[model samples]
Target: MEAERLRVRKDNSLLRKREPIPFTRESNYSTPVRPPDNDELPGEKKGLPWPVLLFLVTLVVPWILPIGPLRLSAYRIVLVVMVLPCLFMWLTGKVGRIRLTDIVVLSFCVWVFLSLIMVNGLSSSIEPSGIMFIETFGSYLLARCYIRGPDDFYNTVRALFLTNLFLFPFSLIEFVLGYNILHDMFSAILPTFNYPPMAARLGLSRVQSVFDHPILFGIFTGSTLALVHLVLGHGDNIARRFTRTAIVGTLAMMSLSGGPIQALAAQVFIIAWDSALKFLKSRWQIFLSLLALATIATEILAKRSLLEIMIATFTFDPLSYWFRRLIWSYGWASVLNHPFFGVGLERWERPDWMPPSIDNIWLYYAVHHGLPAAGLLLLAVAFAIWAACSAKALDSRLCAYRMGFIATLMAFFLTGWTVHYWGAAHCLFLFLMGSGAWMLERKANTGIELKTDTIKRIPSSHQRPSPHRNAFTRRILSETKLQISRKELPVLNPKGKVADLLP
Candidate 1:
């Protein structure tokens, strides 16, 4: 009775025991998994963003096309290659995921649209204004993409710099060979301008590159070069640094371009001002000093004898100076007559009481766009100033580039006394616009609190450590087998009694 009771107790205890849990074998080595993000926007789906695309297009296209008198084939190529692609992508909702910069750019564009409509109705001749709107605004839109990052800002300036650098050798060759690339583009008043009558007289000489005219070439080169140095500074790049030095030396030796000289001087003033503003505490004092320096520089440049000496060393074209004087007088006259809007865009002729400037940028602005349009241009300048200041507030490298670009723009504005400077006028100005937009974009991305609309956590693939276990569980089957092998009971009996497995 006692043995049966003990057996029953053991059976009950065995029955109440919990079943063993399964164990998975694991090694020390593990390969990490980095899953792809599905939430990426359409624009970022592929390589190369939108802004760079636009910059290359506007810059290159106008140089290629055969629009009326302007055979802008090369320029057209740039537009086709760079700008159109970006515009197409943007229109198709493939780039720019509704950025704040887009909104800002769009707002300014809307203003231009309104101005275009107003000018189309108000102008005496509608064609010029209409053409101007299409070309200028299109250029603006294309250039707008470059304003997003410091890399873009620097790269755009670098590209502009290289284009001019490449044009320099061709210009020198054109001067030597007397083969005018822009011959068909212009109605040349003087064919023998390059071959002077006596003693290789370099006076009143203009050197044309592949551009529309010699003066246009000088203006474009001077303006672009100024912009390059203004934004980029005299850096260590072998190609650019050497190219700039050579061009400046050659221009100085030739002394044919007045616009470039004035531009260079103005650029110096701007650089000095930039340096001063950073170190000097008093803002008004800096401005006063800048004004004084600029006036002094102008007065010094005005002396004909000194000008001749300066140009004799490098040979800057003298025709640009006379051209500038004529334009300045005309610009002042236009300002006096119709100070408000000046003429209206591309309205070169005088309106009854209004006087007209030959090729003054300010005059161009006042006449073509009127005061409001001009104000918008000023706003553009203000935006550029804001961008420069803002860039200065960030890291030092960006600050240097921003300062250089700002100074370059200022130089161009000051040099606007001379040739029409259409290329430099728009390109450099638009560059600043892009830079400003870039800064704003950067600032917004970092500073502004972007609220998350939704949250979803994907599983991370990090392996968690296994829980602790006793060694006895691992050897349970082996121990059970050993006990069965050492049995101490009979295998079979008449009474049919079960035997113990262990001794």
Candidate 2:
């Protein structure tokens, strides 16, 4: 009777112990199932996401299509294709959390919509306003959804880099031949739109390449230089990185646009600052103090606004300075007069002698959309910069890239004071903003998840013991006392007899 009772107890304990072993194994295995790092996940196909691929198509299509009479550019066509996908993503919850940056962007769009209606009236403005909203805010949301992680961001950069590489030869030809073959070919097929006279500087023709103007080409190439650097910075292979860097740098110089050169300089400066600040104990405080001092010194020394100084420094044209001064003076007056809702999109009533073009982008927005709209736009940019700088949880290299993006943006904004960017270049601004916001949100969420996991891993004193604790303890003690491996232990069968687990 005693032997039977002992056998029954042993069988019960073994069965209980077996159950907990599987559970412990499962927990141990699953504990390592972490969120993906900056690598392609298993079974994930390595390719650009659909929306990103579509965005790249948009960038290339503009160069291929003839400048049509109806303003049906390639950008419009691709944006139309993007609409359904973006809407579906939003409805299906594929689009991630709505963030503050998103809210600001949307608000800016709404303000632009209202400005158009107020200035142009509801009936006349609906179509153009819709197009603008779709082109700007819609594009931004698409980027935000598609560029969810580092892989997507790098893919986008690669796409841009490839596009630039393809165009580099054409750009060089245009400069050397002092003529644009692509534009000429397209113009033959479609009604030739009026373009500015090709300007010459330093014995070279200012080449527009595949773009509408030299300034646009310069800005595009310059901004891309920063992105190329970002990609090359993270590369493990030194030879590959050096080769790519050389190619991109050579292409950037070939464009010979002051705007891009300024942008490239700005990126280099920001990168150096980032590197230097890392060594400082109070980096943020020191950086801010330096920034303030620099701003004050610039104001005192220049005696003109920093915008004017930047414009003067980048341009060799004697008339460029006077022209920008006149535009700013007239543009500011118009903005103040129509401070709430801008004067209708109609040409500002100025003395016939005054220049029509408001070269400054901020002034352009203010003059057309009112101060409120411009303010929201600036605020959105501010939010993007803040997000980039504050993203502490991102990979260090990615954080550096984000800072480089911010620098690129700042350079563009500064350049906008001298040159007007429309079409694809303007879209690039929204892309950067959306990308920055997405990265910031992703890093923050990952950090939060890690913290939650850490907290969950900590044992609580109030936790109850498992129901099978005594059985588990007995089984473990028996195995230890017997000095046997788990394979040597007896397994319980339906008939309550010891069975060999191993063959």
Candidate 3:
């Protein structure tokens, strides 16, 4: 009886062990495992493609030389290099599918070409139109194709941070000495415009760094600050994050542009909000409430005109308000007259006292490209916002980064209302859009791959069993039945009597 009880216990243990095998095997094959933290998943190779590397080099070139030979900008030279290789790659069918955002950008470029031709005539508009198309649409396409995933995105952030760091000493020298060494060096080699001496504001000389104007330098620093913050927020090393943040902040202050100050303030607010309310159930509700409060404040200040109030509050110059007001008045009139395709790239008719260049980006676009092109630009921005909001990646840190990026975009748009960003400055906006589009595309591809894997794993109803498996199962059942019958049959013991061994 004792031996029999031990045998029964052994059998029960064996059965329990056997039962877990199938469950474990099923789970191993059926359920996907989450990747270990900080480790990239298999098959995702790191490193930027050559085109992306070229783009990064392009961004850095203007800072190094500011201008190239024959009065061409550094960006123009890089664009030529990028376009040729991209065209060859596309012709060879090596490029990915053309996204909707790409199409929209191309369409806007086409409209610009047609409008220029209509206004300036084909012969006169050819060079300007071609340059516009290449600079805007071509750059966007190159960015869209080059940035493939989060790795690329992070690499870009790192590159920008390094670029800012590299330019910091130059900026400091300019600030202290009231001279730009880079400008002087580049001017010697290339024919360049003679800019006025650095003007003192708030008891310090405004530093233009390597950029053409103080405002542009400030804008670049401000934009880089946002990206650095995003990377710092997601980074693991505390010392490195703080160091980068300090460098970016110092550069921003050196630029002495109100835009960077305002942008940095927005970034600080975002970081505070993230820290305080990130875990809250209705964090977005809190954000909306804050926005409502701001709107109410704006309404209360409307009696004095919000523009005047903003100028008084954020800017050092009081005359800026009257200046912008004049631009707006004339720009609106021009838009009203040529509301459709614009006045065909013609200059706005304003009094000689008024500035020729419109400071507002939206007004500039409307005056140059017409309301339709402006509308398309807004639509593209809207799409990018949607894509950023919708992107979901395997790395959990991506959500916070995306939100930070969106906040930066909002800040840029608001600050851009006071300044017209052209040339390379415009590329920053395009790069942001391309990054968001890449995230959305990656999310979509991941979903499709998951679905494909699932379809491949599931057995089809029409699939027949393999002959070997069928034969093996039948043989096992027959052997089990034979053993049971043998156990149930009567057996003769030493007493020569029929004895049943079943018990």
Please report the candidate that would top TM-score against the real structure: 2
Cα-based lDDT at residue 127, candidate 1: 48
Q: Give lDDT tens digits, candidate 1, residues 51-140.
A: 454454334222333557544443344443555655675566553444444444444445545555564554443445434443454455
Model 2 has a clash total of 0
Candidates in order have lDDT scores of 0.47, 0.67, 0.64
lDDT: which candidate is best? 2
Clashing pairs in 2: none
Instruction: Give the poorly placed runs of model 1, Cα more than 4 Å off.
Output: 1-127, 181-205, 224-255, 272-357, 423-432, 443-503
> Which parts of model 3 are misplaced by more than 4 Å?
1-28, 31-45, 60-71, 84-97, 189-193, 304-308, 443-503
Per-candidate TM-scores read 0.56, 0.77, 0.75
TM-score (C-alpha) between model 3 and the true structure = 0.75
Which sections of candidate 2 miss by over 4 Å? 1-30, 40-45, 63-70, 185-195, 237-239, 249-255, 443-503
Between candidates 2 and 3, the one scoring higher on TM-score is: 2
Q: Which candidate model has the greater lDDT, 1 or 3? A: 3
**Per-residue CA lDDT of candidate 2, range 320-418, in tens?**
778778888888999888887887568885779876777777888888889887788788888877877777666556765686677777777666666
